[model samples]
Target chain A: MKVALDAMGGDHAPAVNIGGAKEALELYPSIEKIFLVGDEDAIRAECQKQGLSTTSPRIAIVHAPEVIGMAEPGAKTVRRKKQSSINVAMDLVKAGEADAFVSAGNTGAAVASATIKLRLIEGVDRAGIASGLPNEHGICHLLDAGANPEAKPEHLLVYAIMGSAFARHVLGVKHPKVGLMSNGEEDEKGTTFTKETFALLKGFADSGKAPFDFVGNVEGHDLFETQLDVVLCDGFTGNVVLKSCEATAKAMFKWLKKELTANAVRMIGAKIAKGAFVAVKERASAESYGGSPLLGVNGVVIIAHGGSTAVAVRNAIRVGMETVQHRVNPHIEATLQDVKR
Target chain B: MKVALDAMGGDHAPAVNIGGAKEALELYPSIEKIFLVGDEDAIRAECQKQGLSTTSPRIAIVHAPEVIGMAEPGAKTVRRKKQSSINVAMDLVKAGEADAFVSAGNTGAAVASATIKLRLIEGVDRAGIASGLPNEHGICHLLDAGANPEAKPEHLLVYAIMGSAFARHVLGVKHPKVGLMSNGEEDEKGTTFTKETFALLKGFADSGKAPFDFVGNVEGHDLFETQLDVVLCDGFTGNVVLKSCEATAKAMFKWLKKELTANAVRMIGAKIAKGAFVAVKERASAESYGGSPLLGVNGVVIIAHGGSTAVAVRNAIRVGMETVQHRVNPHIEATLQDVKR
Candidate 1:
């Protein structure tokens, strides 16, 4: 699969991006070619510094001088910076030059660029960011992680379909159990928006025409515990919930570390169980999953974290390639078409 | 202070409630009386079984013949069950016989009974549930924990005031720092509802007229860190966020325990550091905080979890007494009156 990666995206771009690209090529034989979309000189220098052959047939340079900043307004930046790496990379996908596009840059810019360049699949209202979060049962896909702040009830239905499609093929959940994020687990819980969407989805879930099992309602805490395959919510709640959990985990670990080192006896015990702590951290971290895919969009678009490391970037590229191989967009198009009926 | 205890509210009912009342009486010399509100026979039996003096001047039995089930509708149940323990306890507070009311029962019923009978304070539109969540930096109060599903910007101002008052007096947080819960830290990063609230809180926070330090936009992750005293959000978000964090912690501990006991070496390591784990659990558990106070009402109302144990019940009553002693309602009233002027 051919992929166009925004070379100057993330906080530590060029170097980390180049390193990740090289690693991706080495690890995945399916990645036929990668168009390193950014400034030609910077890309080549970083490629050489990272000990990768600049002339390698598998890697190509597509010079794009402009760079969309992480904090820049997304839609405006995408519209203004025609030559930005994010836009240029997406252009490659639009032109059928690459099967997928990856960026760890401005999330908004990435979404806007993909929406503008690749456009949305038929019957799709808006694209959603579907992030794979670590849960007790395994990974659960959280949609609208921050793509659309204000969404209509029908929009959530679209998210559910797209998320379920992504979970089934890309994430490999056989029968994804979909849950609507709400204040409570009761059937009547949630805002009017959720109530309307719940009614539609509940009916659809029972029709057997739906792609997954419909677990009526799920609260914030239920996200990690229940064996749910896909958790759907508006971008605002999803973003808030994701970050809140992240902050909680970070604080807990900080507290744990402080307590563990408070005394020599605790320190000795901590040392012995150091491996277990590391294991837990790894299992709980977002680094393991890398970027989330912007589902319902026409092309494969993966938006990585702004502070992504080389490992995270590599995994993002891997995700992009896997998404293309699974033909998620086509499946989503088919589902949306069915939904429209 | 005189406090009314709803003896038939929670899962364990009369036993835990009676045990908690006794414990509270022993722990706080200031507690003059506890009117155990429930079926007279059941309360007497539980009090006797728990080795409590029924005829003691400090402990009184208030007969409440009916009981509201956990799943009953909030307003309907409160109105229909006039003799329910929760209603009777709230009535005691309304009648000036009890300084505060504590319930380890249906949260909706508690909130409904408190709102309907005790009524809202001057200049307050609605009541809010201010839950004290155990964070790394002592405790942070999350308001509208599950009370108001839809809140106007003005309502949030009241929540911020009420929550700050509870924080400063009962929580002993001096010059409490308050944060408006949003999806992002930036001023512009929130739903339209949150945006307006942010602007108002931002001004109030700066005007120094507000009781708490108005720390602008905080994400869910900010709950345990940042030394923020009170985090204000609509009840829907607050409840979902609170429960989500709880679920995440519980699931993480479960996973940690499983991994630590998977092998002999890991099991030995876990055994050595059991104290540290126990200490960490204690720090994070809700039992340490007791119940959340339903603020903005005319009287002090603390609602414990429906599944609260004896220790939790004891803690809830203690919170109620402390709230009364602190005179949080008057302070909230002053803040609101000042805001209006």
Candidate 2:
């Protein structure tokens, strides 16, 4: 499938974006074309510096001069900067020129651009960002990680359906077990919103109308231990948990490094154990899973991290292509159809 | 100050409870007495096993025949088991016989007992648990960590007040900065509940009637890096964040250990780095904070972890004594009066 990548986005900018597109081209022959949507001059120079020629049959440059800085208001920027890289790239997908849109830009901008340009899929309450988090069993699809903070019970129900669809098609989980994120594990637990959502999910899952398995209420820590495929929550709670996990991991590693290098003996030992640490870090890194997908949109959109490296950007493209190849939108639409009735 | 210790509570039970009380007696000479409120026989045996005699003038065994199981329903158990260790100890505080009560038992039972017996201080809407979380800064106090899930905006307003009081008097901050936890740092970044709470908090702080500094909005990660004195949210959000952080830490350590011990070289390195790891673990541990205080209650009640060890139990007693000394409840009552009007 063809992909439109926002080349002027992320901290590393056009260089990593261009480098990533080139690597994706080499790795995935299935990626027919990558439209480098950014400032024309910057994209060309980065391609040249990286020893890549945009003249290649598979690589193409699409000029969109304006760049949305990371800190700018999302909806405002998208509206004002009509020719911004993010807006233009999304427009490409909306026009059916590209199967998917990928960006390591501002998440809010990405969500806004997609929501406004592509619009939400029919029967979907709101779009959500589904993130793949590492767990004991494998990876758990957590949504909406940040897309819609002011969400209702129905929005969460739609997230459950879309997240399950992604887990089934993209993550290759058969009969994925979906869970509602709550403070307690009991059925009687959760706020009024969650309680209402839980009843709907439970009824639907029990009736065998849905494709995924339903695990009633999963606590926060259960995300890592419970070998469930999909974990669902409102965007606000999901975002809080997601970032809290991120902060905790970052703090722990910092503490670990400080402790390991405190004394000479530990430093020597750290050398010996460097490989293991590297392996662990790679396994736990977000770059491995690429960007979170903005599900329930009319088209596929992958929202990568702002600090994404070349590999991350490449992986994001891979995720985007896979999402398109798996026909995630079609599947999500079909799954949500069952809920609408 | 006199403290009532629930000797039959927690996983390690009577032994640790007795041991902790004895240690607290030696460490804090201001502790006038400790009422070991539990089964008389079990308390005496544990005291004798730990080579301590109940005959000591400062130590006394208050016979409480009933025990509340961890899995028992909280409100019902508290009402039914009136002579339970938790209830009896809370009674010690209620009857003006003990300055404070500490328990490493069922959290629900602790909350219920504190609320029912001690009651909300004066005009407070509800009682909240103020938990100390270890972060980049020394500590960040997170309130309503697991108390009232159905918290209204006014309840949160009171939480903000009580949290600020605890931070200033107990934590010794000159002017505590209180933050409302949200999905984003922006003013308009939260659900309807949080939006209402945010508006109320902002108005109170801006009017200069609020004692603490109000930081508009804080994300989950900001808990560590921001160095803000107190973070306030509804209990559901706080509990989810709290447990998610705990789970992430546990999972990371498990992952690290698996990686570090995968081979002999790493194992040797781990041994060399053991000291640093221990130091980091101790620094990051919840045990160091004793236990979360059930804030806004009329009497001091420290809720220790159910899996608390002897040191944690001792620390809980220390916290209880400190809370009583600081007169946290009275201060909370006074601070909240500004908003109650």
Candidate 3:
């Protein structure tokens, strides 16, 4: 499979991208080629600095002059920076030159570029970003992480469909348990938007045509506590929950470290228990998941965190490859046909 | 100050309520009396079982025959179960028989009863729940936590006023730093609701009549990372973020404990580091905060967690006393008079 890496998109930029490409080539036999789309001179320098051979046939440099700033507005930046690395990488997928496009840059830009370039799959109203978070049972994909903030009830119904398809084909859940995010667990508890969404989802589930079981309304704690496969919510709510969980985890670890190093007794104990901490941290780290797939798009497009490391970038490429190999988009289109909302 | 406790509310019910009342009477000399509103037989039996003296002048039990179940609907139940503990407690505040009302009951029931019985403070269009969460600097109150799910732009404007008053007068911050909870930090990035709210807050800030500094649009991560006093959002978003943060912290601690006790060496280290873990746990506990204030009501009303412990109930009564002693409601009315949207 051919993959296009957004070499200039991310905090570490060309360095991590080049390193990731090298690692992907070494690790995956399925990767036929990796097109590094960025400024040729910068990519070449980073490859040389990182001791990655540019003469390898698996590695190719596709020079693109423009680079989108991390904090720039999403759709606007993508349109303005026509020759940017993100745009070029996405174009590779659009032209069928690459099987997937992966970026650890501005999420808005990637979503906009992918939606505009690749277009939504037929029968799909909107493309939602299904971001995965580790839970007790397994990963719970939070659909519409940030793609459609001003989503309607129909949009969420579609998200339920798309999220279920992703869970079944990609995450390997036999019968995904889906839920609607709300303030309360009761059926009548939600905003006007969510209440309308609830009725629609409940109707679909009652029809006996739902690919996944609709678990009704779920509270925030259910995300981590319950045995849920996909939790459906508007992009606005999903984004806040996602970021809040991330920040809380980060804050807890920070405080734990501070407390564990408060004195000699704790310091020694922390040293002895270092392996336990390392194991838990790795288990909880987003780096393990690598990236969130922008589902409902016509092709595979994965979005990693802005501050992604080389390891994270490599894992993102792997996620992109898996989405393609598993044929998640085609599965979604097929599922959508069986259940029309 | 005289305070009313909803003894029949919460997961633990009369047991925790009676125990908490006993502790509060012992701890606060400023608390003159506590009215325990619930079934007379149940309250008396629990008090006797816990060895609490019902003959004490500071303790009084008011009979409330009906009880509103934890899972019951809010407004409807509050009206139907007229003799419920939550209603009777709110009536105590309304009749000037108690200085404050405190409950570890159904949040929706408490909010409904308080708004209906005690009424809204003049110039307050709607009431909001300001739920506090501990952060790096201090506590950051999330306004409209669950009170007004379908909040308008003007409703959030009232939340800003009420939240600022709570932070300044009760939380004791000199100048509260308030932020609008959105998906991004950019001023233009938010749903239509949040954007409308942003404009109202920005206008209020620009007029130089605002008690707090408006920090434009803030993402979920900023709730912990930044030095924010209050974050304004619609009830639906605020509730989800609040619960998500709580759940994430709990999950992390649970994982850490499991990993730490996996082996004998790590178990020994964990035993030695137990103090550090205990300190962090207490620091991150909702029991420490006791309860969330249902702001903008006619009187001081506090809503504790449904799963609150005895310590939490005691702290909630303490919070009620502090709010009454601090004259938070009058201060809010005064602040609202100074700024009109």
Top model by DockQ, which number?
3
Q: Per-residue lDDT of B1-341 in model 3, one digit per residue for the tens?
A: 99999999899998999888989999999999999999999999999999889898998999999999999998899999999999998999999999999999889999999999989998887889988887788999999888888889998888888888888888899999999999989988998899999999999899999898999999777777789989999999988888889899988888999999999999999988888899889878889999889999999999998888999999999989989999999999888876655
State, as a TM-score between 0 and 1, how close model 3 is to the true structure: 0.98
- Model 2: lDDT equals 0.87
Which 10 consecutive residues of model 3 chain A have the lowest summed lDDT?
A332-341
* Residue A178 C-alpha lDDT in model 2: 91
Q: Which has the greatest lDDT?
A: 3
Rate residue B269 of model 1 by lDDT.
73
In order, the first chain's TM-score in every candidate is 0.96, 0.97, 0.97
- Please state the CAPRI-style docking class of candidate 2: medium
| Per-model TM-score versus the true fold | 0.95, 0.95, 0.98
Residues B1-341, candidate 2: write the lDDT tens digits.
Answer: 89999999998898788888989998999999999999999888888888887889999899999999886767779999999999999999999999999999888888999999988788777899888988676578888898888799998888887888888888898788889998778887788988999999989888988888998899877888887878998889988998898888878778888988898988987787777778777866778987888988889999987778888899999888888888887787777665657
Give me the runs in candidate 1 sitting further than 4 Å from their true place.
Answer: A39-42, A206-208, B206-208
Q: Mind giving the per-residue lDDT tens digits that candidate 1 earns over B209-325?
A: 887788898877678877888898988788878887877777678777877877777777777778888888777777888899998889989999877888889999888888888
For candidate 2, the TM-score is 0.95
- The 0-to-1 C-alpha lDDT of every candidate, in the order given, reads 0.86, 0.87, 0.90
Instruction: Count backbone clashes in candidate 1.
Output: 4
Candidate 1 at A3: error in angstroms?
1.9
